[model samples]
Target: MKNLHTRRHLLKTMGSGILACGLSGRSWGQSAESGVYGKRAAEVMAHTHENFWLKKRDLYKGAIDKDDPDFIWGGGVMFSAVVAATRHDPKYKSIMRKYFEGMEVYWDTKVKIPGYEPSPTAGGGNDKYYDDNAWMVIMFLEAYEMSGESRYLKRATEVLEFVMSGWDEVGGGGIWWHEKHTGDSKNTCVNAPAAVGCFRLSKFCEPKEAPKYIADGGKIVKWTTKTLRGGNSLFGDAINVVTGQVNGGQLTYNSAMMLRAYTCLYSLTGEDIYLDEAKKMGVAAKAFTDSKTGQYRDSIKWSHLMVEADLELYRWTKEDYLLKRAKTDCDFHYEAWKKEPAKDLITNGGLARQLWLMADMETAAGRDFWKKSDKLRR
Candidate 1:
């Protein structure tokens, strides 16, 4: 509860105080390591926020067809970051509204899918990406929670059902990554978030209808864990439905998505099974972190989602090391941002989210982890 309030304050101030001015490009020139936990983190968060609002608004501008918010199913990743930014600040309300409207721009209404195609009559994006649609449901659920809009709630439910249509017994019970008979694999990327969608969307449903989503979430989790669980409690990438070929790629986002799903189930059922699994995934995620290097060896595009899970785990377990990783990860990102600008809203918005979360964590635990008023020697 305190974290919620702190974040709300952090975001509100961040929107009005930092984003109000044209604080574009860089917030601080290179400096030595000195920080007041409160101010420095806000400075960094504002810098990241500017990259999206000023440098790369095209990612969610919602005016284009080819690069719409739902482009390639990664738009929702940026959407999640914006949703987090708004969690504690009302100044971002208008920006958040545009994001909701952006989804409508991508919706293929006649085809019952919400994704990018050139036009309403273009009839191309209707190929149906279950994973993309599932990701939409998750974002829509959050939109509903934030705005209390019945349309978002309805959209989420509709998308959830649409995503579930890809589920079949062929791959031992998991949704295919895409629809329209094109996809051949059952993916952890899809199933893990699909489980999360089921659990969260249940919040607005009737009691009779709610538990069913819980069960469905459990089913998705069971299938994914059984199929994708790798050594050290982390998850692998995907499996071919027909050939039974497993692509053993370990990604941070996949592991984080499962961690999120497990946490949702734990919160829903108050069951140790869910909490224990979440904890296992949390501990296993250490494989991606290198404290000595202040770096994580994974897709930078997805690190934002991955560390998002780290923050979530720290919140529940009060684990110091997880928080430390989160702070160190920010240090890693600060260097990364210095070398190259964030190429998309996912990286920019995600960086904003983690910095914001670090601020909230600092407030809640009386810690000064993100002392980013300093410059890295690199």
Candidate 2:
């Protein structure tokens, strides 16, 4: 197809832009607070927007469109980044419509509880894991907050119903990994982000109706902590429902999502315990770094969430060390980019988004990066 050919050409022509350690940064990350590096990050974000997402059904795949069935979970994190990039600068405003259309490509609205589908979903198929739908809920909420669009909120609320459908008496309390795989293990990936969704959904609703959403989120978080708590202030990967056993593995996003949930709860209730727990998890996440090479063990996509958690920690404490750690981790990724940059949509998009996020945390030019919109607010 014409699109596929163009994609191939674009992918091969990155030549210099992609090799400058993600846009010619100065002094590793010391200038993260300055506008120069922030602008460069925005440029990288723009490159990703052009190469992979000008218009495509499969946002997780390469520059070209494809009928991919995998990585639906990564789509949510990518969507969050997309929505954030659009809000961070008005230059990305062109992306908003394309984003909605791409969502249309993935969503099957005819289902009982409407949620997204894989690319080119046949027969309006609603089949997917609960975690994937939960990821979409997070993105839709971001879109709503960023655009102040009621439709985004309504879509997110509908997806919440579907996500809650994933929960039951299983494993004492947690979301099923997939809808059809009834006996599958309950995963922290689903539980933590779903908790974050519920927390955000609470505020998205009316004042009187908000309490139920909040309570639901609190209950999910409570059950998650009690059911599969890991040592060293970290969390595990999953728990086998059939065998009643926990898979004790720590991942960056799992810890990051919990950190977000805890931070949200603290902000809403003024609870120091939530903040304290988040701090513990933040500390544990740094164990990924190799003191010798200064390289991080986490892949770019997964490690981005850790950077997000670190930024939140920085926000709360105003600690320079947290920012420095985040900067170093980012530097590690860019340094790798100089040699072998990932060409896939998830990796490139994720790296750009996280780098921009880190730079935004320090620079006043991006002061409103975490806010709904950093631009002139349309």
Question: Can you tell me which runs of candidate 2 are displaced by over 4 Å?
Answer: 1-33, 54-60, 63-71, 123-126, 362-365, 369-378
Residue-by-residue lDDT tens digits, candidate 2, 1-378? 453343223323421221221112323236365554456466666666665553445344453354452355556666666776765676654465455556566666677766666454644564667878877787788778667878788888988888888889966878888777555789888898898888777666865556567667777787777776676767788899888888988878787888887776665555466677777777777776678765457787777777777777666656565666777777777667657656666777667767767666555545554543311111
- TM-score of each model, paired residue for residue: 0.76, 0.83
Q: Candidate 1 at 184: error in angstroms?
A: 0.8
Q: What is each predicted model's overall lDDT from 0 to 1?
A: 0.64, 0.67
lDDT of 2 at 229: 62
Task: Please state the error at residue 85 of candidate 2 in Å.
Answer: 1.7
Model 2, TM vs. native: 0.83
Q: Least accurate stretch of 10 residues (summed lDDT) in model 2?
A: 14-23
Best by TM-score: 2
Q: Which candidate number has the best lDDT? A: 2
User: Candidate 1 — which residues are off by over 4 angstroms?
Assistant: 1-72, 112-124, 181-183, 362-378
**In model 2, how many backbone clashes occur?**
0
- lDDT of prediction 1: 0.64
